[model samples]
Target: MTIHRIVCAANRKRFTGQIVLGIRHWDLFMSEALDSEGDPVDQGFVDNRGNFLLRIEAWKVAEAAGQIIRRVGGDDTNGGTLYSENLY
Candidate 1:
């Protein structure tokens, strides 16, 4: 199993999330969950309102992180650019 950390930045707020999945099966899982349209759902964003963290599983951290980066309006250039790294 492999775990990947994905961060979500929204409304000037930032949150830390993670994903866990099998290395071999990540392609199938990611393909189904992500595509050109984006994530299958907005659960990650919704869950960010509380103490929840968006957890996902993928074969590659970069890929999973990419999905998250796209969803949060951060592209390759601005991905993970947190305004405040220390909020907790």
Candidate 2:
């Protein structure tokens, strides 16, 4: 397992975390939530479009899963708000 760095190109913010392996699955665990211009952010934040940025590596995991759905027991207006960085 590797600790990866995720950068939101839209916001220029960064997060440090690892891809956690589960029972035949994988998940993201953000050990360090955010770094906004060198300042630490305690909580999760989204973009103006209400989406989180997923880097290439994370996108690979999601792509391998066939589809990326919201986490279990997570707030569901329908699903999660995550988008691939490559898309933008």
Candidate 3:
């Protein structure tokens, strides 16, 4: 279960600020979640019109995603403002 965490940031001035965090299985699901050229899905977070911040691995995808969400804006009290999605 090679899990990979991806962090994405979207900043469009102060009107709209968004951070997207997600997880996917590298070995089992990455290929399916990505396109033929080894890129994330067309609708995947990374492909969205935003800044791709980071990608990491963890034992638990959810936990790792949460951590990435927390470190996004120097605080973790934004509740569910950080959107999340699973590629698989």
Give Cα-based local distance difference scores for all models: 0.29, 0.32, 0.32
For model 2, the stretches where C-alpha displacement exceeds 4 angstroms are: 1-54, 68-88
Q: Name model 1 segments beyond 4 Å from true.
A: 7-62, 65-70, 78-88
Give per-residue CA lDDT, model 2, range 51-73, as digits (tens): 44333334443434443444433
Candidate 3 residue 35 C-alpha distance from true site, Å: 3.2
- TM-score: model 1 vs. ground truth: 0.18
Instruction: Find the 10 residues in a row with the least total lDDT in model 3.
Output: 9-18
TM-score list, all predictions: 0.18, 0.23, 0.20
lDDT of 3 by residue, 1-88 (tens): 5444534322121222323233532333443333344323222234232344332222133345444433343123333223333322
Q: Judging by TM-score against the true structure, name the best candidate.
A: 2
Q: Model 3 — TM-score against the truth?
A: 0.20
lDDT of 1 at 7: 38
| Tens digits of per-residue lDDT for model 1, 23-43 | 222245534433343323323
Clash statistics: count for each candidate: 3, 0, 0
Q: Which has the higher TM-score value, candidate number 1 or candidate number 3? A: 3
List runs of model 3 lying over 4 Å from the truth. 1-22, 25-29, 38-50, 55-88
